[model samples]
Target: MMKPVTAQDLQTAGFVPERRRGPAVSVAQATVDAIQTMIRTGHLRPGESLPPQRNLARDLSVSRATLREALSILATIGEITAKPSGRGFVCADPGEKPATPSWRFAARYSLREVYQFRHVVESYAAQLAAIGHTDPELAELRECLQTFRRAALAGDISLYAQADFDFHHLIMRICRNKLLVDMHQTFASILLESQRLPTERRGNLMHAVQEHESILEAIAIRDPEGASYYMRKHISMAGSRAGLPLSELP
Candidate 1:
């Protein structure tokens, strides 16, 4: 059995303790770095629940508030996720290998070109989903819509980004075509970039949430034409908010 690691394990592995006299922000950042090191060193497994807040604060020699700030940052960056039970957070699952190197793809494309591709693929996905999805798939879309709405209202850009992807990916899955799904998966990093671009700018976050809701509403009605039209509108709006010129594709 893998022994459950503790704060002492982290210290034993050379995780540096934050200085009490340091600036609060610096201490918080140091806490984040130490926790990230713990993750890399296998002291903390992906999907493993962290220790209770008080215990972790004591272990790191910082106040619970500072520790919390660090955890929030981790959660935002896809490193960890809040447990469904609400007890605490857990490290995110490390899933299968990507078909391509994400960094290389990001290097190869400008944000402008990426959104153009997204508009083409995602609009088609919404059209197929409107005609082909089962009831359960529709339910899942509704759930993701609610999640995205909550994230937007809270101004959590990270959570919003995740929910945004989930909404689109679900559409692809319901489209029932493996090739479309594969292509979308291959371009995952670029899609993530497009999502980040719109949400990163001020005042665009809520705009995106509203736009997604419109797409979901269209999909829910099983209106293929409406779904495609709304998806195109959503992507176009996102591109505009990101300051990219989206000339209608030929």
Candidate 2:
């Protein structure tokens, strides 16, 4: 049998050390940030119709119910307006500034419920990626690893941050689950944004490398249960560092 992935392997791969700390951002916060960043980066441009509910949930690695909550949160802030329940959300410019107090309040108030929905869906996605990832998709995981290592070696915080973010994205792709990938896509930048907020520069990235390597190993060996366990652990570690529980949220 292949040797289980080890911390040494991760270190040898040039993983950066990281410390974890912060107020756990809710799923709504993550979703809102993603929409903001996409506009900031011009990925969605102006007035783009956000993807359908099912599609958004799949891309963001979240549950449909959880994503709906995020949408409600967004609507409160005037970032996107969707009519009634079950309609699509559309992009609206927040102008030159970040969202106003009303929007911020929605995000702050909805924190617990958001996490409750997200953790459940993310746990499920972990299980799916473990089972359905393809070989090319597997290679993407390695590429993310190597890029992160290079960024760490160069002491490039900005680059390391972006790669670290994409690395998680690769995991969803590796799982070959469209729904999961969609869900993850929805919140892509928000996690990074949260990390930036406290500027918590804990040597926490190394722990992540080791954890990711473990997940990859299970996938390489075609062990679904092992893969799922590791994936959930990985998301949990990040959340825990952010001062949130890894299991079901409140």
Candidate 3:
């Protein structure tokens, strides 16, 4: 029988408990990394139930909400599975591969179709934003990019998703085109989901962050063509990360 891993085991494995004051996403990511380290070092073995959430959270010096978010991310990536009784999570066998997430909107729109639409509409929005964005709008976009980078570095997919949405949505608004903004607003949920799909599939996000930086640099220089080109490239790469081949996109 696999022994249950206690919080003391984690502490002894160098999982230092610290009170951090910042975005909960970063804190949650620290929790995720600590748990992963414990598992990697054999303190938490496969099929072992984790310490109860209350005790674990207290030991980690993180809020319960932050701990829950970390656990949820671990579950999503197949590092752990929730117990049948909804009590706590258990470590997955290291040999077991994580399952790929299925597209939930396949009945209405194909993934290729969605990426194509994003490539067309969002690239144009970037072009327009490059020409029309004001100083304050550029500053806001820069801030959004920074947030996205931070979330990506911390491996906080949920926060990264929001930052990704805010970055593109800001571009739509900066374009000052009511039709474009309306279209983005109408399809906000779907767009956000599309953004999340790639992150869930790929472990590293710094490449996408670099792409965003290129796109933003173009926009900051008021180069509409460059902005449009970089946005197209970023969307293409994002699609490829989500299992859609660049050759398959139109």
| TM-score for each model | 0.56, 0.48, 0.61
RMSD of each: 14.8, 21.2, 13.5
lDDT digits (tens) for residues 1-250 of candidate 2 = 2123244433343322222213454554455455455545555555677767776565555567766655654554345655447357566655632422121224543433444544565556556766777778778878888887777677676877787768766766665678777867876555455333211422334555676688778777778778767766555444434434223333
Report residue 49 deviation for candidate 2 (angstroms). Answer: 56
Superposed model 1: Cα runs more than 4 Å off: 1-106, 246-250
What is the Cα-based lDDT of residue 53 in candidate 3?
A: 89
lDDT of 3 by residue, 1-250 (tens): 4345566766665554655444433576578778888888887789999888897787778789989867865765567877889788889887774355577888888888989999999999999999998999999999999999999999999999899999999999998899999999998888888888877662457767888999999999999999999999788767756666424544
- Encode model 1's per-residue lDDT on 1-250: one tens digit a residue: 2355566776765555666344533676677777877877787888788888897888877789989877855654446777878679877665721122122345688666777788888899999998888888889998998998898889888898888888888899998889999988887866866676656433325666777778888888889899999898777666655545323221
Superior by TM-score: candidate 1 or candidate 3: 3
Q: Give the TM-score of candidate 3.
A: 0.61
**What alpha-carbon RMSD in Å does predicted model 2 have with respect to the real structure?**
21.2
